[model samples]
Target: MTVSAWWFLLVGAIVTYGWRAAGVALSGRIDPNSALMRWVACVAYALLAGLIARLIVAPQGALGDTALWMRLSSAGVALLVYFIFRRSIVLGVTAGALWLMAVTTLAGG
Candidate 1:
């Protein structure tokens, strides 16, 4: 990239890091169990759930090529497996991704 591009990137990085440092400095003054913190956690989780749902229903890249039913089915199976196996998140995600890959391949789509 050009010098201007590098300068812009450097400035952006500093700004981002500044915000993080500000947060860290203020974090010590805030209670971990405060209502604001709880609300922030809930909002973050909601955003993540929304993003995942959007990807499964209307993906943008390679995942977009897979069938919706296939994606949903894999997710369902993953949840089932996770619950049945004492909530192993790694196993659940692995099974889910594998299931989606297998069914999508088998379906020829």
Candidate 2:
């Protein structure tokens, strides 16, 4: 809405795209099967798992207000839907969100 905000957005876009462009430039030379790549992949998965665990176990804000069992149940439903839909992330997340809302409202949380 302001000049400063526009400048900030422009800078953010430039920085984000700069790294992406560099990655694209270097991608041809990087070996997907290399040990370094494997390590990176493992680290990424570990970080994701840790974040998910934290959100479920000790969430902040609105989610924190919900009961632990509700959170766990939603996560279970999400996982089940994920597998049932052949690992479709969109469907899994949608089902989980819908389930969480329904349960929370029904239980008067």
Candidate 3:
């Protein structure tokens, strides 16, 4: 990469780390169980959910090559497996990945 690219990366890293450090410094002063904190948590979760839904509905790159139904089906199965396994993250992820691979292969992708 060019020197400019390296410079940008360094600046970006510093900025990101600065924000993280600031957050850490302020963490003790903030009320973790405050209403504002609860609202922020809810908003963060909603944003994450929206992003995941958008990706499943209109994926990009390799994921986009797979059919929407296949992705949805895999996600559904993963959720089911997660619940059935008492929310084991490992099993849930494995089930989702395996389902996606099997569906994609069987579909002749």
Rate residue 28 of model 1 by lDDT: 73
If the candidates were sorted by their TM-score against the true structure, best first, what order would they fall in?
3, 1, 2
Best by TM-score: 3
Summing lDDT over every window of 10 consecutive residues in candidate 2, give the lowest-scoring window: 1-10
lDDT of 2 by residue, 1-109 (tens): 4477889989999998997897899898988789987998899899999998999989999989999999999999999999999999999999999999999999994
Rank all candidate structures by their lDDT, best first, as comma-separated numbers: 2, 3, 1
- lDDT of all the models against the reference? 0.89, 0.92, 0.91
In candidate 3, position 24 carries an lDDT of 94
**Colliding residue pairs in candidate 3:** none
Estimate the TM-score of every prediction.
0.74, 0.65, 0.75
Where does candidate 2 stray beyond 4 Å? Answer: 1-19, 81-92
TM-score of 3: 0.75
lDDT for model 1: 0.89
Any runs in candidate 3 off by more than 4 Å, and if so which?
1-15
Please give the lDDT score at residue 32 for candidate 2: 77
